[model samples]
Target: PTFGEWVKYGLPFVPVMALVVGLYFYFAFRRRIQVKSLNISTLVRQASRKIGPMTRKEYITAAVLILLIVLWVTCSDRFGMGGPVILCIVLLNIFRILRWQDISKIQWEVVALYASACAMGKGLEATGAALYLADRFVAILPDFMHSGTGLAMATSLFTGIATNFMSDGATVSAIGPITVPMAIISQTSPLMVGLATAFASSFAHMFIIGTPNNAIAYTMAKDPLTGEQLVTLGDFFKHGFCILILSFLVMWLWVFLGYWRWMGFINGSVA
Candidate 1:
C-alpha cells in the first residue's frame, strides 16, 4: 500500500534528472533571461532594504525550521517527518509565530483529497486490484521481460501520459501496484520500474488538473497586464511534451549507464 520505498529506490535517477532538467532549462530559457550584476556590498544593501532586520519571532521561526529540517533529514526513521512537523506547528502556535485564525484559513479540502487518494491506494492493494492490473500490463508487454530498457521506457511513458489526465497520486496509485509486479514478471528490477513510474508521475505539467501543484501554479499566474490567464492549456501541453521527452531520455541514459547498479539495485541476474 505504501510507495515510500520508491524514493530510496529512485535515488539512482537523481543525477540524470538534475543534469537533463538543468541543461534543458538553460538552453530553453537562456535567451529571455536577464542577469543583474551586483557586488557583496550591493547584495548587502539590497538585502537590508528588502528585509530590514529580522524580529524575535522571525529568529524563533527560523530556528524551528532548521530543527524540523534536521529531524527530517537525519532522524526520519526514528522520529518520522510528521512528528517533527507537528512539533514545529505546536511550537509556532505556542510562540505566537502562527495563530488559530491562520490555521483555520487553510483549505482542508485539499488535505481530504490527499487522504482519500491514500485510502484508495490501500484499498487497491488490499483487494488485489493492483496485482490484477500488473498481470494485464505484463501480458500486454509480451516480451518486456527480455528487454529491461524497453520496459523502463514504456512504463515511464505510460505514467507520464496518464498523470496528465489525472492527479499524480491517483495515477501512481493506479499504476504503482502494476509497475513492481510487472518488472518481476519481466525478470527486471522492481525497484527500477517503481522508480520510473514514481518519477514519471512528477512530470504532470500538461494539464491544470494533472496535479495540485500545477493547478496552484496556473491559478497564481493571473495576467497583471491584461487580466487574463497567463498560460493556456495548449501552452502547458507544448512545454510538458518537450520536458516529457527529455525526462524519458534521462531515464534511459541512467539505465544504460548502469547507475542503478552503482546504487546496488541491479545485480547480475536482474536487469
Candidate 2:
C-alpha cells in the first residue's frame, strides 16, 4: 500500500505523532541553548549564495523522478511500481540520459542486500518457519489473541523489536503471514494487523545496519570533505531507543482509541 493508505489507516496515530514531534523539538531546543544559534535569515542567505541554479540535466532528472512518482501513485494497480521504475530506467538509457557506466557505479551491494533479505523472507514462509514461529507466538499470547488492540500492539512490538536486529523487509516478510492469520483467528481485522506490522518494521533505528536507510545515513556521516564520523553508534542507540518506545506507545494509543473502528477497520471485540 501507498503512504496515503497508511495515513488513512493510521489516522489515529496522527495526534500521537504530532505530540512526539513537538516534544522532540522542545527537547532539542532546550539542548541547543548552550550552542550559538545562527540567524535563520543569514543562514538562508549564505545557502542561497552558495547554491547555483539547476542545470538542464538536473531539471530533466527531476522531471523524470516526478513522473515516476506520479506513475507509482496513479498507475500502480495497472502497471505496478516496478514496471514504471524499470520503464523509466530503460527510457533514460535509450535517451542517453543515463549511461551504462552510471548504472554500474550504482551501489549494487545495497540492492543485493535487499534482494537477499526478501528472498530469505520468502524462504522462511515457504519452509513453514514463519508459521511455526507465528503459532508459537500466538499460543504464548493467549490473552492478547482475543483482543484486537492487544493483537495490534503485540504485532507492532514484535515487528519493531525484530526489525532492530534484521532488515525491515525481512522482518515483515517473516512476521506478516503469521500476524495476518493470527488476526483472523482472533476475529480481528487482518488488514489492521498487517498494516501495523508493516509500520512497526520501519522503526529499525536501534542498529545502523538494520535497514538500508540507516546504513545510508551512517555512510553519509563519514563526510567526504572532512573525513569526520559525524554520527556515532552511541548516538543511534541513545535516540533510537526513545523513538522506538514512543512509537510503540503511539501505536498502542491509536488502537485503544477506537480510531480503527471509526475507519471501519475493526468492529466489536475480536473475542
Candidate 3:
C-alpha cells in the first residue's frame, strides 16, 4: 500500500493506541503513588529520583547544548545543527565533561564508521561512480517511458534501492547533481529524483551499517568499524533487512500515491 493510504487508514487507530498507552501510564503512576516503598516520602528517595542529575560539568554541557540548539534553529540557513552536535560531543571529551571513563562511554568507533562511509561516498561521487550508473540508466530508458510518471517511479525506486548501500547524505549529495540533469534530459521533474534520493537515503537503514543509529546501537555492544562488537554481520543484516524493506515500500507509496505532489508542487494540485 502507498504510504498515504497507509497513513490515512492507520490514523484513526493511532489515537486509540495513544489513549490506551495514556491510560496504562496513568494507572501505573497512580499505583506507584499508592505504594509506600516507592512513594515520594524520604529525602534520600526524592534526591535519587531526580531525572537528570546535573553536576558542574553536566550543567556546562547542558548550557552548551542549549546554546548550540538555539543557534542551530536560528541560523539553519547559515549553519547546520549536525556539525554543531558533533563538535559539542567532541568538546565534551576535550573539556572532561565527565571524565576519561565517560569519554570512553561514547562509542567513538561508530563515529569513525559513519565518517568513513561518508568519505567513501565522496570518493564514489568524485570518481563519477554514481553518475556513471545514473547516466547508464537514463540512456536505456525507452522513449515512451522515459519522461512519464512511470519513469519517475522507476528512477525513484532505483535510487532508493541503490541508496541502501550508499548513505542518504551521500546518495543525495552525490546523485543530486547528476540525476537532476538526467531528469531534465528525460523530460521529468528534477524534484522527482531529489525526493527519491531523500527517501532512499533514509531507506538505506535496512542494513545495519547503512545508518549511524544502527551502527551506534551495535557499537554499544561491539565496534562496527573495528568489528569488535558482539553483533555479527549476519545479525545486523538480519534485523536491518526487514525494516529497510518496509521503509522502502512505505516511502515508495508516499511518492507514487500522490502524497508528494498533493502536499506541494504544481499549484497544489492532487496527484
Q: Pick the candidate with the highest lDDT.
A: 2
Model 1: per-residue Cα lDDT over 196-233, one tens digit each: 78888888867888887877887788878887987677
Ranking the candidates on lDDT from highest down gives: 2, 1, 3
| lDDT per model vs. reference | 0.75, 0.77, 0.59
Ranking the candidates on TM-score from highest down gives 2, 1, 3
Better of 1 and 3 by lDDT: 1
Q: Quote model 2's TM-score.
A: 0.81
lDDT of 2 by residue, 91-185 (tens): 78876789999998999987887777778767767887766776777788868444577788888888999999988877786778778777766
Regions of candidate 3 where Cα sits further than 4 Å from its true position: 1-52, 66-70, 79-133, 142-152, 166-173, 215-239, 255-258, 267-271
Candidate 3 lDDT at 35 equals 55
Q: Which is the leading candidate under TM-score?
A: 2
- How many clashes in each structure? 0, 0, 3
Model 3, CA-based lDDT: 0.59
